[model samples]
Target: MLKVNTENSVRYKGKPKKTSVNAGRLKLIERNKEKPDVARIEKPTTILRGMRLIDPNEVNKNMICSNCRKQLAFNHIVEEKTTGFHHIWTMKCDTCFTLTKCHSSKSHFNDGHLYYDANTAAVLGAVHSGAGCNALRKIAMRIDMPVLSQETYKRYEREIGSLIEEAAKDSCQGAAAEEQNLVVEHIDTLRDKL
Candidate 1:
């Protein structure tokens, strides 16, 4: 599970305000291998690290360049997250200025990977310069996709790629079938942000 914001540099926001279930419920779910009713903090969980987590296995076809207002290059996927110190967050485009809010599951991958705040990164910096400084930079140096560990990366693609393409195809068909013009306020507002 993941969440992101398009407006401000706030890391993953929109985590639920609080969980309806208590810790006991969580433990029960864990024991049953069922999903937990994860809740967000009073505010959104601060993103301590940035992840490019991408669907590198499948080609991306529903690419939209916020700056261009045109379809982006096929197979183009960009993911930027907050990392390093001071909540360093990034997106694919440098021109994004709009804001958005969304809520998602809190499932971090099973991997030990986790987001870290500047303080956390600093502590880590003492151990690894390149490791603590900039995850975006680090990931780029390692592979073409931001989330590059061949096996994990493929899983990432499998999870997100199909969802994106299916959405695009459904949107297109829906637009053709309906004469009503849906006011996509966010898209219009975020169009200039690339």
Candidate 2:
């Protein structure tokens, strides 16, 4: 039986030696170590940016007449126009008889044409998420939410599809140009070495 000495054996008490890190990797590590500024983070004014499934009773409870400062009754909603997921409600104040137009989503103007933000977003989101109009309609139906017609969905899909295709072409061209530049630089370096 062989006995080993434990007391005389030198144990490392100093800090562990760090392995060499690449300059780019070191920068990433330093960046990740930095704490984000909590004060700089802004909270969204509304619950969600796009369409939200809100109860009609909740809207009635929170609604106030702009002119009279009285609670607007749910029954006072004179007209409602739904475009895809977006909704515009025209309400008449009982006290002041003032008509107020409420919009569920903001409007964006492009080439002098007004487009609902939510409606555009819905089509874009559907395409990005690999979901079609049928899928969206089924989900809406299941949730008891108002569903957009196939015609309306198809119209937005066509418009957005063209835009997406254009963007993809631009991106591919940019990437090709960058790759060509890199190849040219590499050839120049080889010529210099020769």
Candidate 3:
């Protein structure tokens, strides 16, 4: 900044004359301060958990929910606890409580969604709820026909199939809801144009 004296001279030096500045102006000047920390993003809340599986190395790349058939992640397959000789790896989906498996067998079936009838599933020693379904499927799936009963067959015939479908649709709902909100807001803003 340049200073002028009463004699109309630009050189108004007085032992480095210091001018006072307003507090607000001082604040406006940028300061050399430490940078802020970056925020960490969180994982989705709906991710499923508690699934049981067998072989991680042999997990199917395309294996997904058997009911909804939504493609599942390899890491999401939870291991089921069982009394067996072969080593197994398992996981449970966080979004839905669907239990999946990857059993170590001779047939070479990789990581696949182990689905079971909700009704006969119980007879096979697997209950529908996380109460212990994955653990049951690991043992029962190997037994052909799994001793299906008349009542069990009639009851869970449709439920197990629907579980997968519902899960798939649910996985897409959160994004759809956000999109729908944007659309609604846009329509409201453009109401005068219509």
Output the number of the lDDT-best candidate: 2
| Candidate 1 weakest lDDT stretch, 10 residues | 98-107
TM-scores, in order shown?
A: 0.22, 0.57, 0.21
lDDT of 2 by residue, 1-194 (tens): 97655544333345332233344556787886795655656432231223454445435544677788787754667777777687767778888998877665554465788564677787788888999898988887777667879998998888888889999999999999999999787997878889
Computed on alpha carbons, the lDDT of every model, listed in order, comes to 0.39, 0.70, 0.46
Q: Tell me how far candidate 1 lies from the true structure as C-alpha RMSD in angstroms.
A: 30.9
Model 3 per-residue lDDT tens digits across residues 71-166: 667556445333322223354556675766544322222256444322334533333454344444454555522333444443453555576577
Backbone collisions counted per model: 7, 0, 31
Which pairs of residues collide in model 1? 7-99, 16-40, 48-116, 49-115, 49-116, 55-157, 93-194
- lDDT for model 2, please: 0.70
Q: Order of all candidates by lDDT, from best down to worst?
A: 2, 3, 1
Once all C-alphas are superposed, what RMSD does model 2 give against the true structure? Answer: 27.6
lDDT of model 3 at position 110: 25
Q: Candidate 1: where are CA atoms >4 Å away? A: 1-105, 109-139, 142-147, 179-194
- Deviation from native of the Cα of residue 144 in model 1, angstroms: 14
Candidate 2 vs 3: which has more lDDT: 2
For residues 1-194, what per-residue lDDT tens digits would candidate 1 score against the true structure?
67644343322254432343345566786876664345632334443233333333221322334454443431222332322222112223324632222111122332665433233333344334434224534555565433234443334435445665888899998986663344354567556785
Tell me model 3's lDDT, rounded to 2 decimals: 0.46
